[model samples]
Target: MSDYDYVIVGAGAAGCVLAYRLSQDPANRVLLIEAGGGDGHPFIHMPKGLGKILFNPRFLWPFMTEPEAVSNDTGESWARGRVLGGSSAVNGMVWVHGEAANYDRLAELAGADWSWTHIRQAYCELEGHQLGDGPARGGKGPLRISLSDYRSRLTEAMVAAGVAMGLKRAEDVNDPEDGERVGYAPRTIWRGRRQSAATAFLRPARRRPNLTIVTGVTVDRVAVENGRTTGVEGRKDGAAARYTAAKEVLLCAGTIASPAILQRSGIGPAASLRSLGIPVVRDLPAVGANLREHRGIVMQWKVDDRLSQNRDYRGVGLVRSVLRYFAQHKGPMAGGAYDMGAWFKTRPELPIPDGQLLMSPYSFDYGAPSLRVEPSGGFNICVYKLRPDSQGSILIRSRDPADPPVIHARYASDESDRASIPVLVRYARRYVAQAPLRDMVIAETRPGPEFETDAQIFEAYRRFGYGNYHACGTCRMGSDEDAVVDGALNVRGVQGLRVVDASVFPFMLAGNTQAPVMAIAWRAADIVLRESR
Candidate 1:
């Protein structure tokens, strides 16, 4: 049997970083386990490959949400990456740090360690930004955050329109203290490749003798003896295996799998464990509670001007673009899913941005399950509630580790979330009516011309809205009675075990979760190392 000082349960964002940092000391041994295969797929490195892996069975997990009641009443795809980097490998690479106030809020909820001040220091040390280096940004760090080289006139016009509406231009969206987050953004892409956590943190540490990287390992449960996590039990190549953690078994299985794993291991709600025929180790109802996702809906338009990326994504141009990506690393394929976006409050008096508006110079064919761009040049503006009051969950259906969970997203459930839908939609519609876009814009394809009233917009949201893929707070962090993890992120009612992924987020961010997750992983590393063996 193989054993290590630290057994990280997933080779995702936080797990990879922990493997790298913990193995930094020559005496410490680390075992990094991954359920997915090697990161050899070409789709993983391309910035625009999100469309390729969004529905791919090999890259995406088989899990999805349960039918909702309030929102679409349908099971929207919960695209968690079954790869080395986790969702970061398949994400759009939008590197948003979120509002400082949001981090401050999380700090208040979890602990002082999660404060914006400490998080700011972690961000400064963990990122390697392309723009330059200083207190506001990282100069020489493992992760790469760079501005996209691809810029289309339509996206430029979208920015111009937002500016015309009196929105302040942000110098850099990734800048922490930047007064305005309402503008175009610099993404987390390196050169022409995607900067996933696997690429940024894991790759550099792979050669360490103390760090053992194992793939095709499905960790089913954490071996708990007398309420302390001793190790992890799983399967590899259809053969059962178990590995002990000398220090701690870190569950970085992400927002969805982390809680499910806990449930399967008998550490979750007693009812859930009994239903699965698993003996309850700890009766924690908070294991899968407080789940939240940023609510989003798209507004598409068919522009008279054929300036969108839709043209480049079809027919011969598609093949040519692939070749161009391999040859020059500068083409339509080098950019991320989004081109420009802005964060603003529905009501200006709010402390932080409660709404987000992202624009792309292309629309997709959502009529089918596949992600296909439109045949003609069209544009899409995605509006979302950055801080929705609604919460959702991911609960296991059976004792089988391979079984998908019952995800109840209940999107836009709260009165506040429902009320903000129209405001966000109307803001995008107004932005589209501004100078640059109004002149070339033809017609609204989605929510159509009839959705003028707030009620109509609410219906549109229910008909088409989906999660922003920022599902978090499942294994909530805090010292509260309902908290699954304590202030130090250690799983409540269990010793020698901890959660260090997006699942432990005390609350949701005002923007994307990638950048914040990295910073959190960096801080988690510090906390883990301070322990005496």
Candidate 2:
């Protein structure tokens, strides 16, 4: 039996950081296990090259949800990172650090110190903005942030369009500490490589003798005795084994896998655990109850000009582009297709922004078996409802570790979420139909005017929309009986076991969760360090 001061499950964004920070003391021994293999691919390092690995089963979890009834949408399949860096290795690399109100609300919902003022300090510490550093904007950190390197005449035109729409030009949206509406997204890219969690936190800590990283090991369950976590049991290289944690077991397995792991370990709803014949250690009904995720539909438009990346990503050109990226990182492949976007308050009077608009130079159809090409260069708009009211759950279907969990993402179940989405979609359509975008585009590829009316819009949302891969809130944080974890993120029913990933968020934040999740992990590290000391 192997023992350590700390064993962190899942070396994703949260796990990687946790392992790195906790092991910083040098005297403390930490073991980091990742279900996925090494982050050896070239695309994994290239910021813009994430598109190359989006659907690869080797790099993604490829989880699908159960069918939903209300919205006519059947179900959605989510792609989560199965690599060393987790989703950060394969994300758009957009570095929007969530709105101020997002943290403010989380603080209010969870407790004190989690407030915006406290959380913002942590955010500033973890991130290093490349565009420009300020009191609330930038500092010396591992994750490098900068504006999109690949700029075109089109990007300027896009800014013009936003101006025409009565939107203010944000100097820098990635500056969360400033609490202002900054424009031009600051991408999570460093030098030329993708600044994933592995690159930022894990790699540096890997040299430490106290930290051991085991890849391709899937942790099935947390070993518990008398309602306290003892260790963990799982398989590796076709052989099963178990390890005991001498100190604590940190579930950094993310929102989806963390809850599922807890359930398989018999720490969830008694009724559900009884069905699986797994002895219920903790009858925590909130294990997977407060599931929340950001969902969005990609709106495509065809353009008359062939100047977009859409024209660049086809046939022989793609091969050449890949070679160019490998040889040197200064090509189109070095940049996220999304060079520009906006965070806006849908209703003018809201205290915080309601939605985020992701702008790309090319259209993307998730349903396409293979990547399709637009005859001419075109633009794609991805509008996401930031503060969704919908909820979902992850349930264990069987005791088997290989079996996929039952994901029922009850999206659009909330009337508010259902109502708010159409408004964003309509706005996206209208924005593209006017001024600079309208002059460049020919027609809308999705929802195509035929899908007008509230019924049709909602139906289309159900049929086509998918998770932003930002699923969170399972094994949520709070102090109530229903909360799986407390304000300190300790699992309520179990001692010496805490969930420190996006799963701890009491509710979903208002943007791409990567940055905010990092901040939470950073704060979590301080908590763990303080307690351990």
Candidate 3:
């Protein structure tokens, strides 16, 4: 058995950063464990190569949700990364910091120092964006940011369309002080490769003698005695191993895994854990509750332009595209499927924006197991109900660590969420059919022009919908007794144990969570540092 000052689980986005910052002291020994292999996949680096693993189980958790009553005929499958850098290694590298109100809400709910002002600074300190150019956005940080080298006629048309429609293009999307702005999404990519957290933080920190990274290891649960965490018990290569935490134990296994780990350790809903024959450590009802994610539906259309990825991927053209990427790291193959989008209010009368529109110059066939490629050019416009009213949870289905959790996403359960989908979908159709882009539309692949009725559109939403894959709020932070973690990111009832990940989000942010998760770990490191003092 080995011991360290800090034992962090799940070397995903948060764990990687924690390991990097904690080991800066050289004196502090940090042990990090991951259930997945290291981030060495070819697709893990190429921005567009992600399409290769989108549906593959090689780098994914392959966790599917229970049947959604209102949405699709088939239940949605939740794809999470099992590798180092976790979802960051596998996700669509669109980097977003979320609206300021998102953090303001967390500060109010979690109490003190978590406000937008406090959290925004952490975002700046950890990430450096190319769009920011210099000081306005974070620069000189470990994470790399860049613009896509290739462009499609549809992408050019969409931006021109937005400009034509009285919408302003923002030079910087991550600007906290600037009001609403829509622009090309800046990605976590360096040159042409994905700049995953493992790539930005972990790989560089591994050289430190103070840090030890263990992969292909599964954590059973935290070993708690007398209400204090002693260490963790887990399995590595079919061998049982136990390690003690000299100073603290942090659970960065994400929303689903964090709560599942807590429940297995007897620290969740009392009745639920009791049924599992586990002694209760706390009666935190909100442990696995408050689960929310962005629900998106895509509408695709065929095009005749020379700019579509379809043109670049067809036979001889694909070989040229691959060769270009290999040589200069610049080509259509190096670009992401999506190129532009906007964050806006669902209803003009609403107090704030509640939806996001993502536009892409490539069509992805959802019905197929692999990415859908077409001989004719195609593009997609996706609508997402960003601030959802519906809620669900993740729970332990069995005591086995390998067993997947019972995930009830409950998408569209709320009537508001259900109603918002069609309106947004219709709006997406309107955007596609209106000026600039209207002339380019040869035909609609999903919910074609005839599906005008709300019921029809709702059905289309069910048929074409896929999760934005931004799951959060499982081990929520709150000041209330029912909250799983406190403002400091510490487990409510457990001593010397904390959870630092998307799981600690009291409410899901208004946009993509990758940067926000990095920000949380940035602040968490400070919290851990201060507490240690």
Best to worst by lDDT, what's the order?
A: 1, 3, 2
lDDT of 1 at 372: 79
TM-score each candidate.
0.97, 0.95, 0.96
lDDT by residue (tens digit), candidate 3, 129-161: 775544335676788887665555677787666
Clash list (residue pairs), candidate 3: 45-194
Pairs with backbone N, CA or C atoms under 3 Å apart (clashes), candidate 1: none
Comparing 2 and 3 on lDDT, the stronger one:
3
lDDT of 1: 0.83
Which residue runs of candidate 3 sit more than 4 Å off their true CA positions? 132-136, 177-179, 366-369
Candidate 1 lDDT, tens digit per residue, 25-135?
989889989999877788889887778777688977877788776556778788888889988898888888877777788877888888888888888888888876865
Per-residue lDDT of 1-533 in model 2, one digit per residue for the tens? 44787889998889988998899898888999899999989878877667678868899987888876743546566788998999888888877667777777777767775777777777677777774556456567766777776667666666667767767777676555423242567777766778899989987889999999999888999998877788899999989967778778999988889999999988889999998899988899999888898888877777655657765677777778778888887677777746788767678777667777888777664456776656566777778887678888889899988888899888878888978877888878767765775777767777678888888887777766778888899988875778898988888878889998988887767578888788888888988898988
- lDDT for each of the candidates? 0.83, 0.79, 0.81
lDDT of the structure predicted as candidate 3: 0.81
Ranking by TM-score: 1, 3, 2
Q: CA shift at 59, candidate 1, in angstroms? A: 1.3
